[model samples]
Target chain A: MKQIVSPGCTTGPFFPVDFSDGSEDLSQRNGLAAKGQHIILTGHVLELGGKPARNMVVEIWQADASGIFRHPLDPRQQDCDPGFWCWGRARTDADGVYRFTTIIPGAYEDRAPHINVAILGIGLTRPLVTNIFFDARADVVFECVPAELRSRLLAKPEGDGVYRFDVILRGENETPFFVE
Target chain B: MMDDSTMKIDYAPYDDATQTLRQIDKYTPSATRVPSAPLIERPLTLSERTGPTELVSKWNVGKLDLCRLAPDSPRALGQLIHVTGRVTDEDGAPVSSVVMEIWQANASGKYIHELDDHRAPLDPNFTGQGRLVTDEDGRYEVFTVKPGAYPVLYSGWWWRPPHIHFSILGTSWMNRFITQIFFPGEVLNEKDLLLNGVPSRDVRDRLIFKPTDTVMGDLSYIGYQRDFVLRGHRQTPELP
Candidate 1:
């Protein structure tokens, strides 16, 4: 018998209130247009059995077009975009789908454009950390992953600055996860 | 290979007694256990390292008060309490300037969120949410009320022990830790399956906060201290 439940699920259900305010739409900050190409990232959170994982909270944090984060710990010399709200959070709906309206983040150091994702919900023991990279820059991070499984991390462009990146929590073809 | 026999090595072999103790130490019944799931491990890249940004302005936007959200209201409902703690690394060294986000149910066992539709009365003056930035000495303090225990529809009906949710973001993505703090001496602590999920008794005890006497002017608030040790050799165990 398993001795412990995952951290998030142990507390029972947590219906996170939308704490992001209007920051979900990263293209504009405080009503002013941000300096970057606006993009919409959409996906579904699925269980290992391929069932919809409903009520999951998904959070994304990324750098701005200038490749600078707003966090005080960041030691980079790049200037942060005052108009970009680099953090966003949302909950999955009944269909286990989550969407975020943001811009394509610029590259940082030797890495390409990617968005850092953290997922948590009732069944999750801890928040799952992962990355979503574009198909063009997938090679930069997916070098060690088999060619067959690399596509799981790629978010394909769906025309007009929109991308589709589904996240499968478990089972065959599950999305790649990262540990600290 | 150089001189195996000359080098002194300390070791303990597995035995029946150790096995039995291990079973007790790691035992968590399936009925109360959260099942294991698949996870991938990868080193963080430069982008991932620089991705997360502080939401300081957003957290500080409104009147920052966990006890009283409404500035006009003098005091929030329920017993006033003070929570103070320090953030440290696994080595017990202070980790300064870490950001912590916290939220909890109101004193009436009801959340301020719309999704919480329990029959309990909502405290309009209390939002039960706030953020704290650790000082140079890794110390932080917040004023809140004792949250009421609430019942959930688990196994017919199960009442959860009073707890406060915490979210801590360390310097790196690997240091992100989320967990709950429970008040010490609550009878329900022994029966709480969630609290029992932690296998180590000593580690589990670390999650509980003991009450202390702390006075603020003429008003006296119950004081509680709980320190958080971030990632390192003696890193605090996450819920699992």
Candidate 2:
């Protein structure tokens, strides 16, 4: 029997009941307000057969370096940067390309944590959530994620404020994605 | 072996992550040659419960403008009802300029997402995605194909019945909603811990199915209508 790694389906639901839509105009200020620096984190969603995965919903939520979320319900609004909503969502195209344009988040006291993503495709009972961290803080943040996602946190900073990370769904070196 | 009329399986173009085939890999001999499953007929009448329906109002429309369904979009089953509607704050106004992204499987149960690659080819005509600005009337339209039934990795098990995943963001940074919209009359709805967690029947009813409308355009697309109400201390938040 092939071993399947993943704690039973429940990845704590982060769905924002207050706001469920995914269309945010680019004109509005993104999570990083002052820091003109932005990174384009893009990747393709491929099926087990290696074809582009289309129409899959990809959601990402993270705290500003100051640990503030865009959610109004967030109780600890301390250091909440008005400039940073700190969360975004996108759908993968037929080519499986899903991209997010935002600023490099600063670290929080929560221990060098990184942004997390959850991908909910068809057929699964639960959603597949994963995390991505800054290369510099990989060591500290590595432990913040579960053992399964630790391997997939590897991200190479491509030139021009863009980082490239590929999500591997299966295999011996399979990478698991995470979310808080 | 030379007498065989079989051809070699081309695995080169596929990425390394996908080439590894194991028993779990549904795409082996059955995966590639698998014929498209027949779409389920939508249901007759879905009982609507009461309470707060998970609302999906647009906040911000992002750089990704395309909202066409993927080829993998489940053929609409007569039994499955789709419910799509616009969400706004307390004020009866539409929040325009937003994108509504949804994912689901066909009646046979399959998600169009690439990760669910074993089931269906990405529906070229169906994006399983849509975009809209609340009409001047605070209304938004969702154009998508119904979802299908598919598989998942749980405790040595499989699930049935088709459902949809919804992610709605505002036109600005203030509010965003992420939710899953389930079809009515599904036995799985009761089994689905998430669906039962909602407090009220009214809210749960909002997640039920309805017919797609062609008022926006044509009936070729599956349409589900529902309205989202985002209440807060104030009205719409300005774009940050």
Candidate 3:
């Protein structure tokens, strides 16, 4: 690899919770409701070897119902919902489970509706970067996901607005991470 | 089989896998957690190209100086030092407004975290956490003390030299870089398992920051510099 930076180091179970400064709810801003279908997103983060990844931090960023990102990088005209912050953070509990209260992200240019997730954990040398689409078969860029790995990246819907997704970091039913 | 967004953006196949960490076999945590499975290579769609910029500015985040809790607070116990660095992309262009968060052990080689039960004395005034934001030139500086060395638990006679851990958030998700800043001339740099895990010797040296000629703060604090190069946008002349 031409990249020359030092690879990375494990947090060694000493990560400071305040460093992340993350949130669990992105659907409301300053007590105002964000546009679109407000839903509950929850999941577990386990090692492919089946170890519960406790105290690890997860960050999620997505577009609002207008398919507009709150970020300045979205080149489109600024039109995101005023109440949606478009990003959140959650830490896995003792059972490796994390929960987030947000809304269904809308599809954007050439890409399907999805949530971008970046994770940092006790044992992970590098933060695992991945995305979770809303379905088994998503449109556009998701096609790049191999058919067999599609199940790993799709969010499984429960009875109501709650969605369950599991992130397996190594060895077994691991979700496919992305690199440009 | 690809999207016809030819008008919007061009995508590239997976950039070859990132540098692999050569396990030292002693650090049991990474040995089991490092993914052995292949990761999916994909294009830098909007999701990867954009992220929450200036996260620190929005929140009431403050604490760039670790030696002192606040400007008026008492200085933590240790030798105060100022760390300076520039963040750039592979193209050597500056990536401004990036948030760089750092965590380290106190001067006694002890972390304030509950997991760390080392007998080293923890400075009551020091939490050992600091954060900074890069300027338009991608330059950042933070005030901290030289952390002490501590032994690796369960590892026979393994000691980690003074090192600071860094998590840098760049323009996008893929640009996120996690690394450690080592002090130059520290004998421990040569013995650190995680530092040596990096395959290349040259890259290992890059992790060590060197002293700067000019002074940054009052004569009390010393300045050291190291520049970082994060992955940049893939070059595609064929794209619109």
Selected candidate, larger TM-score, 1 vs 3: 3
Error of 2 at B112 (Å): 14
Clashing pairs in 3: none
Stretch of 10 with least lDDT, candidate 1 chain B: B14-23
Q: Write down the lDDT of every candidate, Cα atoms only.
A: 0.66, 0.44, 0.74
lDDT of 3 by residue, B85-156 (tens): 888766566778778878999999999876686889989788698677788888888888889999877677
lDDT of 2 by residue, B1-240 (tens): 111111111111112121111112331322321112221121110000000111122233432212333334444443323345765543444544445554454434444433444454544444344434445455655434455655444433445345555554443221334555666677767654445444456555655555555443434444566566432113233469
Candidate 1 off by > 4 Å: A1-12, A30-32, A70-76, A136-140, B1-38, B51-53, B61-64, B71-74, B214-217, B232-240
Query: Mind sharing the TM-score for model 3?
Result: 0.88
Candidate number that wins on TM-score, 2 or 3: 3
| B183: Cα error in model 3, Å | 1.2
Candidate 2 chain A weakest lDDT stretch, 10 residues:
A2-11
- lDDT of model 3 at position B233: 37
In model 3, which regions exceed 4 Å deviation? A1-7, B1-24, B54-56, B61-63, B213-219, B233-240
Which wins on lDDT, candidate 1 or candidate 2? 1
Model 3's DockQ score? 0.44
Model number with the top DockQ: 3
Per-residue lDDT of model 3, residues A1-180, tens digit only: 234333555665666777655478888786689999988899888875788888888888888887887666676627778788777888888899999999988887687889999887666666777888897555655787788778888888896898998988776787787652
lDDT of 1 by residue, B19-81 (tens): 111112222322122223434445455455433435544555332468775656767789889
